[model samples]
Target: MTDNSTTTSSVDLNESRAPLLGAVAGLGAVLGVIAVALRFYTRVVIVGKVFHSDYCILAALVSVVAFTICNGIGIGYGFGRHGAAVTPEEITAQLKTTIGVIFFYHLSHLLIKSSILLQYIRICVLPVEKRICYVVLALVIAEGFTWIVVLFLTCIPFSAMWDPGLPGAKCIDNTAGFYACAATIISADVAILVIPPFLLRHSSIPWYQKLLLGMVLALGGAATIASIFRIRVIYMATKGTDPAWDAAPNGLLALIEVDLGLICSCVATLMPLFRRWHPGIWPRRLRHRGGNRLETVSDLNCVCSESKSTASEDRGGKTDVGDAVGSGTKLGPEQ
Candidate 1:
């Protein structure tokens, strides 16, 4: 708990926090909105239909709204600022802000991970990969639910979390919770990021389009990197010294990680707009790398999660689908 008596150092910390927290969180929210907007347009307008993954994205977007609102409140309450600057009466308010941030942080990750899982359902084709994906999804759900429960119940009598001296109050070490959640996020993100590259390995699509899909899928890794940084900040925050100051970075990183996850997931589904912008955007030499080549490129709307064919059927149509990949682009595969 922070001392009631404040120091000049506390004021300095408090002054720096507001702008830094707002700027980082605002940037994340903006980037997330832009990416998700593109994804929605790509699905509803360009593809003319939505899939399971789109629904997931929608749900994640709702949580993002909640997360952003909580972020504003938290920062307003001196969340990332020094706790000593908070008056005794304001302590409860600051603590409530912390609760809001934690609650929404968990929700954002849960929804974003679910979105990625649903995206995997639409795009992953192999039986082995499908099995792996299913297991990962189950774990993600379990982990997310666990964290939700843990965060909500972390301090008994709930208010004890903020008012540390409350009688009969007990709180769990938050570092454990942070570690568990970070592990879940990193593993799931890595799996989703690696999946597309693995799926296209033997794809009948030309190497040019194959490379493009690979690049798109790789975008999910940005979230994974953000998660790592969030974990580092979490470790520091859980150290129990000047927590309010520490929490600034912790909360900021959480917002960025979840927002980045949402953004990356949405971007992975925006191939339609990319292909639409340039109908003839295929590269040559890379097209020669894949030994066997197809006459048609699959501008698969499913790349945007807009396909009628199951991922399995597309296995046979790999060549045609690859050819159809762009709105109106065709590159001759080297003979």
Candidate 2:
């Protein structure tokens, strides 16, 4: 009777949480799609010129969608159920799905970071700022590839990751590896978050616009916070015996982090759309009141243009009065 009672309690305690995972994944996928779609629309229609960053973001969105779909498949294979409640076959299937999930998750983040850095490189005029972005971009790319390689190499005879009893199979300490990856990601997130504020400080935009731009970029903090929470969840999941159940939060948080990153990256570019739909909505100071129209230059483009003009003036060159009136000149070749 005691044994039976314990089994009942175990089953009750480990009731499937797949519904929660499904809901979060579904919501994140939908939001990601919408955000990317709006970003493309803004760039292609409103701006009339798509950029390399736009293409990179679109690729990130595709990866995010694939990640969400893989999570859903894993859920169907008892991913959110306690290991004790899941059959061996179900666990194997979920493990197989997990490989894809991890791949797409990392791929999405890599593309997103690259997209943001490319945009920064495109708009930043200062040599120091551009150099910083390039350094960070290199780190992000290196970290992404390193994690991906480590993922595939986690288990020798990689199938042993799921079938741990396979003869002579070996696997690294994946929990420690995950921690290292998370740390790298957090570091990169901090760098991405800090770069914009530093650049903005040196920009020639009005103080109010700087504040607004800072606030928009500040949304990246949401993804950073999500990464921190994900690390916490990883630690918690490692402590639990029922990895299939405990790890659900890790997947959910991963989706949230990727989706948040993609959304935040796209929001600043959507400014042109907002202005087009509601021109008078901007503050009088932000909008052109006299012959000095702000035009429809993107926030980053405006900063780039003004920075170049400032640099030109600082060099004691004759500055065109029209340049200050939002001429919307292309800074250089699109990076």
Q: Against the true structure, whose lDDT is highest?
A: 2
For this target, which candidate reaches the highest TM-score against the unseen true structure? 2
Error of 1 at 92 (Å): 2.0
Runs of candidate 2 with Cα error greater than 4 angstroms are 1-9, 284-335
Q: Please write out the lDDT profile of model 1 over residues 195-220, one tens digit for every residue.
A: 66665664554556777767766675
Q: Give the TM-score of candidate 2.
A: 0.83
Model 2: per-residue Cα lDDT over 181-278, one tens digit each: 89999998888888767766655545666676666655544589899989877765555567787788888889889989988888767766666676
Q: Which ranges in model 1 have alpha carbons more than 4 Å from their true place? A: 1-14, 206-211, 282-286, 289-293, 299-335
Query: What is the lDDT for 40 in model 2?
Result: 80
RMSD (CA, Å), candidate 1 to true, equals 6.3
Relative to the true structure, candidate 2 has a C-alpha RMSD (angstroms) of: 6.1
